[model samples]
Target: MSGSGLSSLAAAMESAVQDAPGVRVQTDVLIRAATAIDHSGPGSPDWRARVAGAIEELVAAGLVECPRTKAGWDRRTLPELPHWVRRSAPPVAAPRMTAKPWHHLLHWVPTVDSERRLSSAERGLLDAVNRWLPAADQVPVVPMRERSWGLLGDDKALEKLRSGRLFVPGRLTLELLRCRSTWPPVQQRVLGAGTWLIVENWSTFESLCTAAEADGFDGRIIFGSGNQVGTRLAALADKGDTPASPVLYFGDIDVGGIRAARLAVTTAQGAGWPAIRPCRPLYELALASPHRLRVQPASADTVSWTTAWIAGELGQQVAMCLTRGEAVRQEAVGLEILGPAPFAALVADV
Candidate 1:
């Protein structure tokens, strides 16, 4: 009612205590809260002046001891706790992690002594290192090699790459970009290249690239596996104000792939590039004949089950084959649809 009777310090201190990692009851926090309460609250305007007089009149002083625990940062307690601003939270419990250790969320590190700012590279490297550790309630420092200006930390940049960037120690360039291990840095194109094709999965991209080369259609190939297709769309579409080039997307025939293709076209169009419609002959390939469908195991947590379930106990696998219309894994068969090289020179057109 009356300002929650809480001065800024007491209210904030209690909150920090609840959110702190592992556990905490820092004695310093208590001292500060007590001091603030005595000096500023209730009948104490010139409270500091009255402190010396009140101390002489106080009783049972030495009996109270600060609380201590092994759970978190140093906290203070007493034999008989005071009205204890009674933090609206409960005590933190340690994790009983097994092979998969359950770690806290924050990974906090105290700033009392080592007050320093983290470099971009250093922060990236720390995040990379943390992947090896458990969760924490506090933020911790991780060591890494020189950071990269090339490795921008914005969400948009990472989205474009479809991978998380992290700093690593003993590295020459900035941190490494994450991607499917099979993926290679897009380099020069091959000779028998056919028309350019962009796909959402690397395995599929590889299969198609190889398949096209086999047929003497050497052209540029790209993996748009991570959904966010900013760069590929740029190459296919013109820059803002320029004409967009034609680019074809080859993805699954299912609704998800359709969504991804639609997004690519829209993004390209918005950027003033020529937004090409994606082509997945594979969808037609599967639907042209129902017998070719292949069934796969179902996991309840995924959407694969919703559209794929068939009748009988064999429903999961059977439905999977029909709903999406076959695995058609990139490795399974993308070359036949891609055909031979005819458009190999586009990569150099600029």
Candidate 2:
């Protein structure tokens, strides 16, 4: 490694260690800093070796210490580089939140902090909220993006408000401003307490909706529209009058699908909704289909957790298929497999 390259790597490692003293600087961070000075490029064969040599040079110069191992230095690969520590660096001060003039409304605005301060953007948003609150009842409801754009000059600014990243006065909320994304299409066949089937793909959603309409299925049929189900499930919380219902999710048997299902479950649970479960019968039908698509192999943990949701021989089949990098789409179990009375058989057993 060149002098400049070694210096840059040492600086980055020192900065990272000082930022979080006990924390190990990630291998990628060191690699990225080295890449800025090394002309060999990251794709080159000797890039990792060069990086490993530079780390050793830093360690020998007493710039950084490898905490993991004392010897076998020559045999260690770039990834096997010992945890780098720098205790001599000065302690980093905690960041103070920007104080704001809106401290008077601290009770109405739970996010306001005296010890901490708010950013200019947050203060601006709070100012807009204060101005909007008294007139909120009379102001016409508008889409969240539109209101966000009108106030903040950025249409998508309020997107993370519900996630608690941004603060809004209790009196003025996303609902009052109509900031919510359009609710995912839903067909309520059975009004009261019953299973709510959330399907991932459009084709599967249509097939289920058609079957429910034809058979008068005893539940709600929701179109998940892929991963959007994570955010869309919040709509269920708005239905205060309706009794709590069991939610079942059916999606493609792939990494993305599994992630979407997990996200939906978490989002639902966070919103105080019923726990979302895998629709076993639907999954079984999907697995039995002759058609299968080749997909990237999911992690062992993902495969294990997904199979745990489904029981018996079918879960094993799912695990085997995912392990082999094969996926089964929810559309596989269409009207042909679902038949006219799809929910009748699935809802009772689920």
- TM-score list, all predictions: 0.32, 0.58
The lDDT leader among the candidates is 2
Error of 1 at 74 (Å): 65
The best candidate by TM-score is 2
Q: What's every prediction's RMSD, in angstroms?
A: 23.2, 13.6
lDDT of residue 175 for candidate 2: 70
Name every residue pair that clashes in candidate 2.
97-116, 97-117, 98-117, 98-118, 99-117, 144-179
Q: Model 1 — which ten-residue stretch has the worst lDDT?
A: 55-64
